[model samples]
Target: MQSRRKLRFRLIVSFALFGFGLSALFAFAALNIRTRVEDQLVNASLMDDAKWANQQAREHPGAPSGSRLLTGTVLSDRTLYKAPLTWQSLENGVHDIFEPGPDGEEHHYKLAVYREGGIISFLQYDVSREELGKQQLLFSVIGAVFLFGLLSLAIGLWLSRKVLKPVSELANRLRDFRKAGKAEPLAPHFADDEVGELAHALDEYSARLTAMVERDREFNSDVSHELRTPLAVIASTTELLQGSPDLTEKLSERLKRIERASRQATELIEALLLLSRAERRGPTRGETTEVGKVAADVIESQRPQMRGKPLSIELAVNAPVSVNAPASVLSVALTNLIGNAIKYTLEGSVRVEVGDGRIEVIDTGPGIKPEDAERLFQRGVRGEGAGGSGAGLGLAIVRRLCELYGWDVSMRPRTDANGAIASIRFS
Candidate 1:
């Protein structure tokens, strides 16, 4: 079977991903806005510095030392003022560039250039401190993004658990209901939401299922009770008819068959009733019966069926075996085992072995199919090679009876003999 991912894990991952995406989007927006605002502020500061320098240079044209300006005559091809290597690249406008300061520290500068009377003037404004502040703003935004992402992840986890707690509790309650055969009210503790609706639905389903189970048990009990009355009457009437002595041989045989059939029917009814009772109230204690005697009686009762075929049924007792179970249950289970043996075997004998707390029926019939062994005792299931006129309920009934009395039953193909062995071990 393919494994499934848990709902809680999916919920957590989905919420976490949503949080991460939202955090990344906000961080990107913040970084873009901070970059734009810092650029505008730097441009304004550089323009103000350029205007101030121009005013100073105009006021004191000859003494240019008071103002931070480099004035040079570009009419001749010679250097006239202190300039960097790339100073020629400056145009007649403000430009931001990087240059080395006196201490060799990297500095950001705004270079403003103007030309008049064959002379070129350049104004340089140091903006490295403002650049450092911009860098700090970038770092702070990055740090905020990281922190917010973590916070979002934490919040997602918390919310996911809060949302999935009711689901987990419902699962646990359902498990408890299965074990104890009862369901507790779930909507009382949860809020009025989707989870609460689900719990309420489950409560309704549980009620319906419990009612169906109760009705089924009652139906089976009532049917079994109704069946016993007629079966008892038939058994008593058959006994009375069998006691009559003025009958012919043919009539006597027919009556004997009727008596056997009636007794078998009555025993089946009793077994069914016992099985039904066991279902409702569990296994009940009964008389301790000798396993050997039970096996002998089963064989004797099956003798009539074996007469037509070349089959012999024998019972052997290794030790005085006994079990605490109803006599009818033991009889029905053994009868079904021996009957199957007799019905399937064409020419070989069927042996019944009784030991302490154990009974085994070894039949010289066609060995059971390996595939059928797994569900051999399931109701209405017949093996592929089972050549019989049965509805396949005998072994099922035997299984139910064994379960009722705390007995273990198993069936397997015999290795030494071309047949099968069915065993019941009592505890």
Candidate 2:
């Protein structure tokens, strides 16, 4: 998975790492170069001292060792055999030697050997002081690396705060906009920079979004107002026709269906308008809807969907429940659940249960696939066995309505039969 840490955190980390790495590389290079130069100079000096000591021994036959030499006298056949075994094989060049001292600590030194015929000269120079100096330099370099890293971290903190200020201000303003339910231009509060450009873009997008929303609300209001007129006329006409003096029984039944459909359409329009406006169907104005009644009405309205499929519709009210919502909202939400249950079931039964602070529609039909259970509630998504000219928006509208009213809706496959159960839990 990718990291979700803020950009400022990443920037700070990058700065710290860069500073640490550069400082460490420079310190390492400096230490290496210094060690190489010091080693070269020490080796050359030791070699020159040895050669001069050899010349002096041959000229004066005996001479105190040069100041750089560890041995004052050159060993001959008698004394050479008694010298340290490591010094016996003398070559005409410089060499480095290491051996354990009497204290079990290793000794470090440079060896310069001069050999001529039966005479051999040995010169040694201890490098313990140089080793001590290199150790001190190593410690200093390590300290400097750490010091630079800390400085980088401090600088990162300050720079991140300064750099992210505009972005942070933008976020704050956006948050305030949400709380106030309004959008204001952010570019005015910022300087001409990348953040300012982002603010300008956001402003343009918000304006477009606000205009689109306004257009939608106006269109929905206009459509709903226009449609209410026809639905009223149909309802009044159906009532008048039902009172006809010679109305036949079959004709009367058909008229009653027409009346029910008109009423349903009117209620659905009110509910959908509330959804489009994103207005809560609150009970502030004496509106408390009974769950069982809405479920029954929705079931009756959806019966024509059966199409002589021999399907049974059932309503079970195990408990009395009421909600602080408009009856039309409940009607629309229940209509979707009950309608879906009826649509998918060719035969068998669709049962609606309203109680326990919620409602559920259980249907005996081709059960939903486990994977498609959640997707079924999404817009433009339908079950595999869906058979209709539906655009697959019923469940999506239902879900949006439920969210507006602080309710939850879900569907699950039934374990006992080839069916699905849809639920709405009111909160």
Q: For every model shown, what is its TM-score relative to the native structure?
A: 0.66, 0.91
lDDT (Cα, tens digit) per residue for candidate 1, span 1-427: 9889888777777777776778778877887887788778756655554555555555566654323343222211244345565776566666877878878988877766654443455566777876687788778877877787777778778987898888888788779877986678877878899999998997898789778978978987788778878877877887787788887788878777777777777778778877765742322565477778877877777888877788888788988987766566788899998888888888888999888778899988897976677597998887544465778899999998888778899899998978989999988
Cα displacement (Å) at residue 39, model 1: 9.6
Alpha carbon lDDT at 324, candidate 1: 66
Model 1 vs. true fold: TM:
0.66
Model 2, 1-427: lDDT tens digits are 9869998999999999999999999999999899889989887877777777767766776565453546534666666886688788757787888977557888887887876645567777778778998999899999999999999999999999999989999999999999999898989999998999999999999999999999999999999999999999999999999999999999998998999889879988998899888888566578687899878878888888897798999999999889899887888888888888888888899988878888889999988888888998899987766576688898998899899899999999999988999999999
Badly placed stretches (over 4 Å) of model 2 are 1-3, 59-73, 76-79, 99-106
How many residue pairs clash per model? 0, 0
lDDT of 1 at 15: 70
Report per-prediction Cα RMSD to one decimal.
6.1, 2.6
The pairs that clash in candidate 2 are none
- Top lDDT: which candidate number? 2
